[model samples]
Target: MTTQGENIAERIKAQAVSLGFAACGIARADAAPRTADRLAQWLSEGCHGDMIWMEERAGQRGAPQALWPEVRSVIMLGMSYAPSRDPLALERACDIGRISSYAQGQDYHDVVKKGLKALARWLVEEAGGELKVFVDTAPVMEKPLAEAAGLGWQGKHSNLVSRDHGSWLFLGAIYTTLELQTDRQGQDRCGSCDACQRACPTNAFPAPYRVDARRCISYLTIEHKGIIPEEFRAAIGNRIYGCDDCLAVCPWNKFASSAAVNKAFLARAELVAPKLADILDLDDAAFRTVFAGSPIKRIGRNRMVRNAAIAAGNSGNGAYREQLERLASDDSDVVRDSALWALQRLSDG
Candidate 1:
């Protein structure tokens, strides 16, 4: 015989699936000890780089009750955005830009938030109780909570790796006063597989369990505010925003998220292997128009062009020489500096 709570949990899971989320489960709000310790050490080492928020809210992160004391239960959820195309093959082509799987469509934050809010509304209307839903926007330790809820286990990359969906799922959480039935906690299945670490182009993982963001290509290219170091320029390939090498290299991805987002994420005509020369020609208006909904829009034109300048230098295609020279004179100091660096590299070759 099922209790009222069990029925609610099952209905919630059913509605969550109906809403397009790939998986859902519930866990009692609790301290994520392992996640907490790692985050503490990472902050202690100052590895988060320019993201000061990671330090500012260190106390709230991974601490369920710290964010909201009444959080008796945590509902973990995932929405899959795995695109069916080859992100790797697209990188080498050098004509199309590669966007991370999550950035391809409408921001997952908006999509998931709407769904979570609806679920929370439903929970209140039917199940009755106070509840709060958070997409990745919160300090809540979503991955660990997802693990605790039996949705998945954290891979060596420390991202949640789901058995059914692979690592291609985006996670969100609902902190509630409801004492829901709990799912079994997941166990680490990464066992002896260092594929995620070995695949990093920047060697971001200082150790199997830790990622030093300073050494990560995604950090340098997207998150880091200043000039990219010369040593890593060539290795960055044509990846204009975020590198997928680590996530894509994970062997488990082959089994689970073996799909891709539709044409929205499919390398846009201009983005895929676009010539560095073509990108350098864009003015500010063009930049906004081109990547309107894309995450690349966040970096603005200066930084992106600066990155393009690096690609131009690495291009070795003498045809782009004039284009590189034009960017070498870009109004922004950052852009000119990168253009100059690429010009020198190209000239030397």
Candidate 2:
């Protein structure tokens, strides 16, 4: 016979599914294993790079309960954003810019947080519990909590990978004061696969299950707020917003379903293999207008143009020389520098 708490958990999960979550599981708020020491070690190694916020919030990020003492249960939810086609398909097409699949559509933080709020409200009505919803913005260690909730295990790429959803999940968490039955933890299914590591264009991973964020294309493009280091510019290729090479190369993705349950995750027609020349044309107004609801807008016009300049340089197409030359005197120093480099690369070729 199921206990009352188990029955309530089942009902809450069912409600989450109805609210469009791909999967939902409960975990004890304090279930994170080695939560503090591991984070301390990663920060100590300086793997987090320019993302100083991670270091600042290291104490609270170490565990969920530490952030919110009253939280008895954490409801972890997964929403799938699986692409309709191969993520690696556009990698070789130099003229077109490649966006990581997650940023190719509407911003997931908005979409996932909306669903999280709805679920939290429903929980309040059904169980009368104090709840706080969080997406990626919080100090919570969502990946570990998701693993503890049986949603998925952190893969070799240091991302949550589900047997059902692969690595295509956007995670959301709801911390509740109500006691809830916890699910069994997901086991590490990655026995021996280095495909994700081998596929990294810059070898961002120094060892298994570890990533040097300083060398990661995603961090360099989106998070690092300065001129991207020239050493990794060539390897950055056409990826503008983020790089999906590690996630795309996971063998476990073979089990991933093609269709996305959330329409918000589906790629916008313009973002799918956008031309470098076109992206180079986006001014501040045009950039904001084009990516108003997309995650790409967060990087701002200068960074986007900077990334486009790098892509244009790697294109090996002399046709974009004029565009590169025009941007050589751009207002932003990073853009001007990147554009000058692109012009030189093209000139040398």
List per-prediction Cα lDDT, in the order shown.
Answer: 0.78, 0.90
Error (Å) of candidate 1 at residue 47 is 1.3
Residue pairs that clash (backbone atoms under 3 angstroms), model 2? none
What are the C-alpha RMSDs, in order, of all predicted structures?
2.4, 1.3
What value of lDDT does candidate 2 attain over all alpha carbons?
0.90
Q: What is candidate 2's lDDT per residue for 88-199, written digit by digit as tens? A: 8988898999999999888999999999999888888888979999999899889999999999999989999999888999999999998999999989998988888898
The candidate that achieves the highest lDDT relative to the unseen native structure? 2
Q: How many backbone clashes does candidate 2 have?
A: 0
Question: How well does candidate 2 score on lDDT at residue 34?
Answer: 85
Which ranges of candidate 1 are over 4 A from the true structure?
A: 257-275
User: What's the number of clashes in each of the models?
Assistant: 16, 0
Residue-wise C-alpha lDDT for candidate 1, range 67-173, written one tens digit per residue: 88898889999887665666687665544445566665665667788888988888899978898889875788888889999998988887888777778887889
All candidates' TM-scores? Answer: 0.92, 0.98
153 Cα displacement, candidate 2 (Å): 0.4
